[model samples]
Target: MSMFDKTTKMAAVLKGHPKAKEVLESFGLQCSTCSGAKHESIELGATNHGLDVNELLTHLNALFDEPPGK
Candidate 1:
């Protein structure tokens, strides 16, 4: 399973990924718990949040490159 699958909450994605959080917020996603986020996958969220999906995908993949708990 992908790291994304290992977690059930958006907060988990950012727990060890401050850079990724910054990137997300830069796209105006103030909170993963925000209503809009509930209906969007991170990929879709990035698209609708005014982010460049390709860039976000690259960054997010990098964030997960290191094993968790490192």
Candidate 2:
């Protein structure tokens, strides 16, 4: 199962996943540099950004499916 969900904190996601910043950026979320990322959940961020939470989560989780050292 994926480690991230809509309720997962942005900070935790960024910290726990090596490519989280890239994934978030691709979805137009500058979470890595946003102060709110410290406490903001993916759902909240997605809502605020007008992004589909489920789609964002799918892309975020897909980072795990990459081959090692990608």
Candidate 3:
């Protein structure tokens, strides 16, 4: 999948994606289960929370882009 895939839902990211929750918490966002975030895209969340979208994107990518067991 492309790094900037807007179709990725935040809920799915948190549910099955490993780095999502850690990144969110590092940014002081602890409510991954909140209804507003359940259906929103990562970009939407970054915008709403005043976070840098590019930084979030980098973190998300690092989680997925690394070699297995690296």
Candidate 4:
């Protein structure tokens, strides 16, 4: 299972994650400047922006994947 799933909140993902913000931008999610953007879930944001939730999760998880030997 991925650490950050589709139901994960956008703010939580972006928090302390500059790379996440960049990835979201690359995915064409421009909600950072909008009201309640931080409160939106990943699925909600992706759906509202006409993006594929699974694909977005794939990209996001890649950016935040945990390393082995932890």
Best lDDT among the predictions, by candidate number: 2
lDDT of 3 by residue, 1-70 (tens): 4454555677876875666688778987664767876778878887888998778777776677767665
**In candidate 2, which residue pairs get closer than 3 Å at backbone N, Cα or C atoms, i.e. clash?**
none
Error of 1 at 4 (Å): 5.1
Question: Relative to the true structure, how large is the alpha-carbon lDDT of every model?
Answer: 0.58, 0.91, 0.72, 0.79
Which residue pairs collide in model 1, if any?
none
For each candidate in turn, give its C-alpha RMSD to the true structure in angstroms. Answer: 4.7, 0.8, 2.3, 3.6
* Top candidate when judged by TM-score against the true structure: 2
lDDT per residue as tens, model 2, 1-70: 5989889999999997899899999988998889999889999999999999999999989988888799
Measured by TM-score, how close is model 1 to the native structure? 0.50
TM per model?
A: 0.50, 0.93, 0.73, 0.78
- By descending lDDT, how would the candidates be arranged? 2, 4, 3, 1
- Candidate 4 lowest-lDDT run of ten: 61-70
Candidate 2 lDDT trough over 10 residues, lowest sum:
59-68
Candidate 4 lDDT over residue span 1-70, tens digit each: 5668877888788873557787889988765676666679999999998999999988888765655532
User: What's the distance in Å from true for residue 12, model 4?
Assistant: 0.7
Residue 46 CA displacement from its true place in model 3, Å: 0.7
Q: What is the lDDT of residue 11 in candidate 1?
A: 57
Error of 3 at 35 (Å): 1.3
lDDT of 4 at 50: 90
